[model samples]
Target: MAQKNETNSAKDQSNASVDQYLAKDPERLARNLARALEELGKAAAAWTEAREKGETGDVTTAPLIDMVRTFSRVSEYWLGDPTRALEAQTRLFAEFMGIWANAIRRMSEDAAADYAAPPAADKRFQDPEWGRNAFFSFLKQAYVVTSRWAADLVEGAEGLDETTRHKARFYVDQVSQALSPSNFLLTNPELFRETMASDGENLVRGMRMLAEDIAAGKGELKLRQSDASKFKVGENIAMTPGKVIARSRLVEVIQYKPVTKQVLKRPLLVVPPWINKFYILDLNPKRSFIRWAVEQGHTVFVISWVNPDERHGMLDWADYIEEGIRFALDAIEDATGERSVNAMGYCVGGTLLAASLALMAAEGDKRIASATLLTTQVDFTHAGDLKVFVDEEQIQALDKAMSGRGYLEANRMATAFNMLRAGDLIWPYVVNNYLRGRAPLPFDLLYWNSDSTRLGAANHSYYLRNCYLENNLSRGRAVLHGKPIRLEDVTIPIFNLATREDHIAPAKSVFMGSRFFGGPVEFVLAGSGHIAGVINAPDLGKYQYWTGAKPEGMLENWLPGAKENPGSWWPYWHAWIEKQDNRSVPARKLGGRRKTLGDAPGEYVRTRA
Candidate 1:
């Protein structure tokens, strides 16, 4: 009897163990099983569709087939439990929705579907009302329905016991706001215009273009791959190994190979914005601004901001001035043995240079002979659409998100810039690339657009809050290295250059920097937007600008001093720079050059991400 009892007790213990195992992680097992079932269902459905429709194209069937097979394998692994299988099914269903979303985004509309000439009678193409109505009716409805379905789930997340839901909601809201329709429309008015640009007689041309996009199986505007192959740093420069200062965020300083004899009397220092790589000014021999300065008989040196690491989490606007600008200035002085140098700051870098000049003036360091600000803003009151993304609530939210990450990821920064010109930056590309299935040309600007750099969380937050959102820099409330700096205190000769159509730094807003400088100042309104205006070469025929009396406030005043000049802004700039030239003083030692390293330019910039 005792032996029989022992056997029965052991069996009972084994059964209990099995039950406990199932109880411990029922949800995970359930999810796995459901996912497997979903996969199998998809596979069967695909096979049936392929057989019925006989569709074998790469675009139509390959991706779907692969997905079906993948899900099938998943289902087979968890087929034993029905509950688990159902859970997998639900998860897979959600994934299916995502796939559909992507597919719908790429689908061409009726006009885009036909490559042939569109009928002249289709007034819809001319007025854009037809195209707009068709798109909004279908897409907007789908979006509304989709959101309505997800609304309960999003709200329900709040009622959940876990904190994950709350945090997830926060992130979702941030992303949603970043992609808000108002922001999108404001940034890409061009897209709205392009689609709506056609009049009754021109309707046929617009429809045909849309149709060609569909027939070619290309997206409206494909995003070309980035080419970081052109500009190199350390390899091109004849510097000792230690002399090169590289921030992954920035390329190395450019060393100009002297080709022309009539160089400037003073050594040149070029400052670029941290948002872009320095190569914008050094793209190619013909287009390179840095090269032009070098050929002008000037000893040119540029600053390459190092890419920020997570360790730089606490870096702020003042930190950049103290470390980045101050360090570069000291190095330039040491290398060339010059006590003072002509400083040209581009965009945000110009803003920092101005602030630093103020600080330097307070300390009585007049090392800056002349200060030139290119497409920079000192005051933000008139800053236009750039403001739409930086309101108090948004900045606070961004601060919270970056608070833990230490650095703002590059993708986030790229998204913000893209939002600034949605039509130009986003939609046409969406139509050509995603919908039409074509890639963009290998253009230099396109390549640069895809290359991005990260900013430390603290630095970015401080900039948005202080400089942009609050306009503190112009207000004289901005602090640098623990000291308050005033823009008006800058006594150096100031040259403020602005682009007439620059959305980033509107001409009027950039003009304010001169008024605030309280010193000898000259303002030049260049042709085109931010980048083109700065890159305008004197020989480039497609350019013009103006320089004269300032315009009054609150005027929609793009053409306040507009004129059709004959040449690019480059030669004009050279002339302006010549006027500021002092007597050619012998290059004195500032003390940092150890030895000549190797070549004219360097290879540090070639290092890829």
Candidate 2:
């Protein structure tokens, strides 16, 4: 009886989960769809008239033409009689209504709910705008329903190719973005009240900023950046004492002064992601991983990548490896006279570092003793939501955009990343900077995020098509320097750190590297998202990490055998590196032959994109 009761309870929970997924906005959606169809019709007619009269070359008509065409494509999927997506939505919604009706029947009999967790979408509805009035409440709920409906509609589509599926998902997400309460003046009562409280000054300022942003960024709006006054590089951020040992078109190698007299025998070289500044590792004293590493009695050197412009647009990933990593490695060896160095890479830097190491191995070079990758992806098969924009049409559009500018603009990339977590990264700014007319708060991470980098046309296009679109990197098709590069060539032991909640490189994606390697691997599942998970120092003492033996099988299979350990994963990494084949040696002097290339944070880091 107890076993039967347990089975029944589990079934009830599963049913409740499905109900939540399908429940919450059919009538509201139908009405909106009807309203939208009417507006689309009017716009289509007007655009058709403009096109027939040869007046459609104007900006407004140009955009209207594209939108009208997009509407036609969407209609074929949603409203077409043959493969009607709307029919599926209606059927699913009817099933949900049936569930609701049964729940009502149960309520009539006073049957108690067996308690289930609320979905994340419902969390935003707790606002007074949703709860204060029935109309607003319906609107809020309706928005959630429509957003889910759009997502479900795409997920349920039949006979769609990968490219079509990708495009459809992106279009649906745009629909959700358009319908967010934060986007509208009247729909968001809180923002309307904020505008009223500010006496329309907020609207005026928002308009001014919007115009300025459109002008400066070519219709791109920036959300946040770290003020130099608040985050001075040498003084507050990247304060770890270091001297530039090597300077190249691609990188500036900074060899940090050892904090201890006796350091690890092998020198440490950190390769940060080229997408952002190296200062992220040395952000502030409290969160500086570089500082922590130096204090651990290890000689350290870091590469600061150049903020490339149109001039560097011809440089590819091969160029990045040869000019960036190889050059930096030689300098580190030249400075310290240590041929073997413990190497570390963050994000894409890690990806490149692994590739470089593999190439070096193939070429009979074993200068790199060990490697540590933090929040990096070696496999692109599961690169998360960013894959939404990786289809042929989108890639072609991006290629055209890059061709116009000679490189993929920073704002364009930032916009995509921001849209991935719109509620967290975008809508708050919309409410604060636009509605409330408030200045952006001083935030280091946001500043780093906003301080975007351009991807060279040669490198960007190649990487996008080869790695992301084709998944060539993991499949052993990525050839750099005339020879095929495989992660299996990486014989050195690896310490791979991945954040549990990293949306950029999902933890499972990082774990896939375990299957790609040729030697021992230690994969630590850290707490928090990508950045937060990495920079979390031991002092913060927040977010626990999980540990498991480097074993075979699926991510799910591995997780069941893992043990959770509290606090920062940094110390664990330090201990792991120390336990490796390292011996104590006297701290080496800073610079030698390379005529100290300016100060620690080199000229390249200060150049604004």
Candidate 3:
């Protein structure tokens, strides 16, 4: 009777504390809630307006349809046999039972209770309350157990083809991530505490921010990854000194100012992926690959691709090769008076450059001395989760969607990329920005990520069909400008750099692609993911890279024989570049014969999607 009375007294004290917090700012919270409602109405209006404007297309439903179809196949395999279905259910039920037992033990203050825990890397359940409080502890354990059970179901299913299995896993992951207890305000302990302390002002501010972001996206939620107002392109971000020496309908060739007295005779041309702006290479002086190359006495010329819109819908791969790559080559020759220049390409840009090299080889155009490919793939056999979205039905739907607008919307591509690591990229922001009502800290990388670019219908369609779907490039079946371009024909020395943790282009895929090239290939594996791995500066002395014999049978086989080297691969690559041609010439001014269009970043990058 005394213990019961003590428990009741404790409960009464907790209720009193909550009431005290609630009464602290009732009038303020009431006014804020009214404002929040008004903002929500505005957000709804913006969404409705966008729908009326036909901005959000049938593309959204296509994925849902594919997901359902894929899951149906998986379900058939399991549900067709009662035994298998029973086994799956039993497995999940057993896990839940164990979790319930553990929860009971924890509630009884049993220190020896073996509580189910989240992975150390999972940031969601970092709060002390998640482990200490019985309610949150149960919620966390239940979510973990359920998510793993779902994953196992997809993995254990039999007779499903590789693609179907892959889609099933991806879909399961998406659903699990979306349904995580951490995503809900009430279920999340930290968010719940903030709500109580602030008297719901956090939610009011969050709603206002949501409305502003929706309006900014012109209907879509822009999903602010960073405080974007903190940075600008030329003034702070892309501040590398350079001039747009030449311009075309598709690209602007920027020749960076020489920081050294003499530079390599072979002018270096950097072809960055058009999916995002070229400033990624020249993000800042400390992190800029272009600046580092210029400082190393190499005449750096970068291709600044236009953020395509309706007018660029008709431009295909052939047009990109002609107007973008070849045009830059011509401008490079005119500016430096150097016929033989070294070339580099990054991601999709690398793919395009490889194709162009094949075309150039066929036409007896030997302007390019050597080739450097950064985190690139000519083969897509192991292209990772991106393949989940690239089958026939989805592509057709995408084509229809793009045909209406003449381009794929910027946010569409951004959202797909974000989904690749939704736990890291999407939910954290959602919880922080919307639930916590805290603005994201200023991050240059996130800022660049948010500055997305639209994809031309013809170009994107061609890329998806040829590269991801057919795998034609490495197979020597890729046709360009009425000629079937073959990678084997291009005998130039190639430096292929693959990031170890790349989700976009798996290291194995890159290793396999090395076999397609005709020339001597130097395969280097860098640490970190696609972006951080490539942009790593030697001055910072971060991350490691590996160099080995020519990419042999498989990545697994190559790993044991490889020698690990410390720090950035920049110096090693520079050494290789010097070995190719050590001859140096007096540093030439910005432009020669080609007319200067504008400053380094140019007008094209300034045009936001």
- Arranged by TM-score with the best first, the candidates are 3, 2, 1
Per-candidate TM-score against the hidden true structure: 0.61, 0.82, 0.96
**lDDT tens readout by residue for model 3, 1-609:** 999999999899668645633436778767777877887888899888988987688687888999999999989988999999999899888988998877776666647444568887889989877876667888998898888988888898889899999999999999999999999977988888777678778888888888888887777888999998999999999899889998989998899999999899999999999999988888888999989999999999999999998889999999999999999999998998989989999999999999999999999999999999998899999889999999899999999999987999898898899999999899999999987888999999999999999999999999999999999988889888877889999899999999999988889888888999899999999999999999999999999999989887999999999999999999999999999999999999899776788888888998888
In order of listing, the candidates' clash counts read 54, 1, 0
Query: Cα lDDT for residue 227, model 1?
Result: 31
Model 2 weakest 10-residue run by lDDT: 55-64
lDDT of 3: 0.90
Instruction: Indicate the residue-level lDDT of 295 in model 3.
Output: 94
lDDT of 1: 0.58
Selected candidate, larger TM-score, 1 vs 2: 2
> Which structure is stronger by TM-score: 2 or 3?
3
lDDT of 1 by residue, 322-371 (tens): 67666666666666666678889998888778888888888888778888
- TM-score winner among the candidates? 3
Query: What alpha-carbon RMSD in Å does predicted model 3 have with respect to the real structure?
Result: 2.3
Is 1 or 3 the stronger prediction by TM-score? 3
Write one digit per residue (lDDT tens) for candidate 2, span 21-139: 23145555355445544544543455455456543222223323444454456566667775475577676577456444544554445343311212646444445434433345445
